[model samples]
Target: MAVPYVKGIMPVMDQRVYVHALLDQFEARYSGAGGQFRYDGQAWFGSDYNKLWLKSEGTVGTDGRFGDGDHEILYDRSISRYFDVQSGVRLDIDHGPTRAWGAIGLQGLVLYFFDAEATFYFSDRGVAGRLTGSYDIFITNRLILQPQAELNFYSNSDPARGVGRGLSDIDTGLRLRYEWHRKIAPYIGITYSNMFDKSMFFRENNGKNNSGVNFTFGIRSWF
Candidate 1:
């Protein structure tokens, strides 16, 4: 006997669209010098194999000025069970003159289910890149601990933006939270940030330590 197959009930996707957004970091950071706010998040919409992604992350500096860290619009294609290829454009709209770049990157899970991303950028200012990774360790069904880190580099320095050549800065932190619900969790953590070389000043004479340990409290959510 042959079992009947229902096309509509099959697992294969046809022409449906899906949307998801995550506010992975929306918190305030306090250090000895001052307090500031930061956010990092991304959203996507598409079918299982193709999608469009939007991302934006930045911080409000101690001087109460805004720093536009990364703003991107990308086209994403699923390549494997846990990876995607992305090509897009990025904009830096800090207090200085705005700059744009051509961007490409790879994002996925690797080596024991770590979330990782590597992206490269090209523009008249030469080239730049970023690498980031985060991992979650489960302590219970609902309690989880996450450690995250990010590195940024540039080939040419842009004085207007206080960006230096070579390796520029590093941000790393750890947070622990309980899943109040499947889509919402509040967490508290600590993050250390350091800036290097000529970029520290944002201009030359205004540079401070450019390094500090900050306390962070934020919420992580998706829907």
Candidate 2:
């Protein structure tokens, strides 16, 4: 006797991974009398519904030599269509007492256009929070303008890191770029930064200015 023929169906799963490098900033500061570089980027692995995420950002000064800077590393989970809730760590690696922080944050696209992030941090020294927002405007098919702002607040003074209670600092910048390709664009911009409250006093005591402007020239890219 011959058995009846049958076919088995198997479930299919979709999986993918991606990496992007965003907001690369290299600029010369007039007040600090130095050059600075900054970068923010992320990578993720897994399926559409769930994934492991890694995000990082850092800044360094280049006056005569390269030195340590403030850096962050975060792990994130996508909980909604437009947002990710993240938690990780931050390290202040510049010319002061090196301090580590526990970080929790939300990053996402708002209203289908604006990119925004808000993060809170806790350290042995104090509590801190940072909020950032940026929007892109297209003047033509290839030419684009971006305006960005970041504000930082603290719950206590951290003289070791030059931060203060209440609002610590605000930074704003405007950039215009012509996309040479979808992956690369050289841009020019200006940034204005100001420190407030006890943060200003700390700067003054350290022989640094409380506010300044920077001229930025850099390339923004991703892959």
Candidate 3:
């Protein structure tokens, strides 16, 4: 009998260009404040090792008031199998006065499953930071439950924006989604968010609601 030889698989993980976009939250939120629309999404371009990332999120009330219109542009470099380092700038642009910050961050997966990101910001005003994480639990092949949370903090207060120092605020939600296709999911969820400590006090002084609970329905899609 003759013997046959076999070749092993070759690595091809980071050789070509790619583009991706995710509309993670595009929804309507109903609350005591009334009806509002919100969007949070990101798009990126490039190869596995290097890329450009654009992220933006905002909310609009029925009266056409826009809030939290945060946008960021970053250069991202893959540093490990589960992590990337990002640096760039962030802009807070809305109907109100605009603010800008220089940003640096780490974005990656955790424990082989959860998605997480930690970013720090600096401006003439002061230093700031954000941490966000999300995870999905499969109820079935096509049905899933996802929980997400985000926290924001600052080193100094910005009275112009009504931001307070210390642990500023938190947002969290629990959503159940059903995938009509691998690329699209529609979900319904309840979101609870509040400002904390001095931040809450500042909001009260400014005559603003410091917290809210909302019922949300939305579609999430990716390409």
Candidate 4:
């Protein structure tokens, strides 16, 4: 029998692409916690300013070793010299809760692109929603920084099985990078977040509040 790669059965493991692994520690009033590692990838096809992109990402909790996966496909069109529009479908693939969501975004050149995403989840756990926004600021020919924010709203949890409290979560973070030409760059940044009424889905995050500084150093480039 041929084993599956995504579910980590056997034989097919060689087909997987390794993307990222990191440990992030947080300090909060009630308890301290750590973040897990993440791996992600994107594939693109199409021509001109119009393209189809498929992306997949997964995370593993550092403490409890819980895992989750996300996959999405986007269709992008360049509307003009200074602006572009994107429409996409997102799928959350984990067993505990799964979701299908839609999003739209706009891009610009001067400061990269500014994007906003709205999500709706389909799960017995709850019908959750979230809003997110992000942008990049170029400091020099080789250096750039991005600050991002997200807010999550939720529907009441199932009285018997749900784990969330139907409140909101707010998260903010920044990323900085130095590019070597258009292909390679090393980066770093920080983030602070607050979990409103619900316990974080990850066991590592037991408390409702978290604040942390992160250092990132990686290489990215076009071949």
Candidate 5:
């Protein structure tokens, strides 16, 4: 009798990678005491439902001095069509001693097409939280308007870093951009930022204005 032949099973291959970046806040402040630069961006790689994500944001003075910055690497899992649950480690690099925190965050698109992110962090110093929201309005195929806001809170004061407990600060801005291409756009806008509660006191003692409106011009791009 002839021996029976068997078929070999093939291994599954379901892998993908993606990269995206944005210069969310790269502009010059016209009314501020000094020029400043800010940036926020992220990149990720993974399969359809799971990914390794890295995010970073920072602010600096034009004199080439670093101010405040945070970096996070997280495992992101898609929980729904519009949201992702992320848990990771966050590192704060600023004027004071570097601190590490456990971070958990939610990122999603909400009703009325708003992009939102909320993250909570805890470290030996204390707990902190950040909330950000933004929306885009289209005026034409190439013209767009964006409004954005961010709020920060802390549980304890850190004099070395000029941070205070409770509600620390809020920043709001509006930008109008003309896209030369889908991946690049130039924008002009105005921003209003203010410190609250003990955070205001810290600014006062440091001879800094508690609030101001600034005119900004910059470019927003992604790839």
Candidate 6:
């Protein structure tokens, strides 16, 4: 999986600028490889805020195994500094299981234990959705800690061709990253995904949620 990024407003400007690019690969008996590139801009409109962004990423293997790339457009509004409402569309372009979808996210970054997102999609395969939540604590200026999890849910499948995993998956991970001057950072982390037990989708598609660890090393910066 690629590094995920979110942008709102910064303390310095009435409106701020941020851009990031990330790459990650997991190699093992089961390998999943992917990366993400994004550009975001946000500004304040009186009290309500507005943002627009574009991102592209993909994943393969099992955890870092074989997978495809996904791209998306995000537009959102922030009711306040700590709370926000967002809506975005995602599409699979390369090695597609091509689909288009929307989502919403909530974050309390200043506080701990509370970042979440829910997504619903109309895919070429079927209708599906996922819910993910995470908690984070900044241990120091150079170190930030994150614990996260995800659940995938699917509805309707092609039973005859044996297509689609009508199951939900659970993933848990501990991530740590170091930031250098708020512009560039290198990080490494690990995760375990349990894809088999929760839903028919995982069981049927043979999308087993074998636990795997991820290692990521890359540069993150903006101008």
Q: Which candidate is the best by TM-score?
A: 1
Best by lDDT: 3
Model 1 bad stretches (over 4 Å): 1-11, 207-210
> Of the candidates numbered 2 and 6, which has the greater TM-score value?
2
lDDT of 4 at 110: 44
lDDT order, best first, reads 3, 1, 5, 2, 4, 6
TM-score-better candidate, 5 vs 6: 5
Tell me each candidate's TM-score.
0.91, 0.82, 0.90, 0.58, 0.88, 0.59
lDDT of each: 0.88, 0.74, 0.89, 0.54, 0.82, 0.51
Q: Which run of 10 residues does model 5 get worst, by summed lDDT?
A: 9-18
Per-residue lDDT of model 5, residues 114-218, tens digit only:
999999999888899999999999999999999999999999997666678988888889999999988889899998888887778876786544367888888
Q: Estimate, for each residue in 93-197, the C-alpha lDDT of model 4 and write its tens digit.
A: 754456666755553454445755555554554566666676768899889886777676667643222235665556666767677666556566665655454
Q: Stretches of candidate 4 above 4 Å error?
A: 1-32, 39-43, 48-50, 63-66, 74-89, 95-113, 119-127, 158-167, 201-223
True lDDT of residue 142, candidate 6: 82
After superposition, candidate 6 runs with Cα above 4 Å error: 1-48, 62-68, 102-113, 123-126, 158-167, 197-223
Model 1: per-residue lDDT, tens digit, 57-174? Answer: 9888778777757889999999999999999999987665789999999999999999999999999889999999999999999999999999999999877787889998888999
In model 3, which regions exceed 4 Å deviation? 1-13, 204-210
> What's model 4's lDDT at 219?
43
Q: For each candidate, how many residue pairs have backbone atoms clashing (under 3 Å)?
A: 0, 0, 0, 3, 0, 18
Worst 10 residues of 6 by lDDT: 36-45
What does candidate 3's lDDT look like per residue over 140-186, in tens digits? Answer: 99999999999999999876565789888888889999998989999
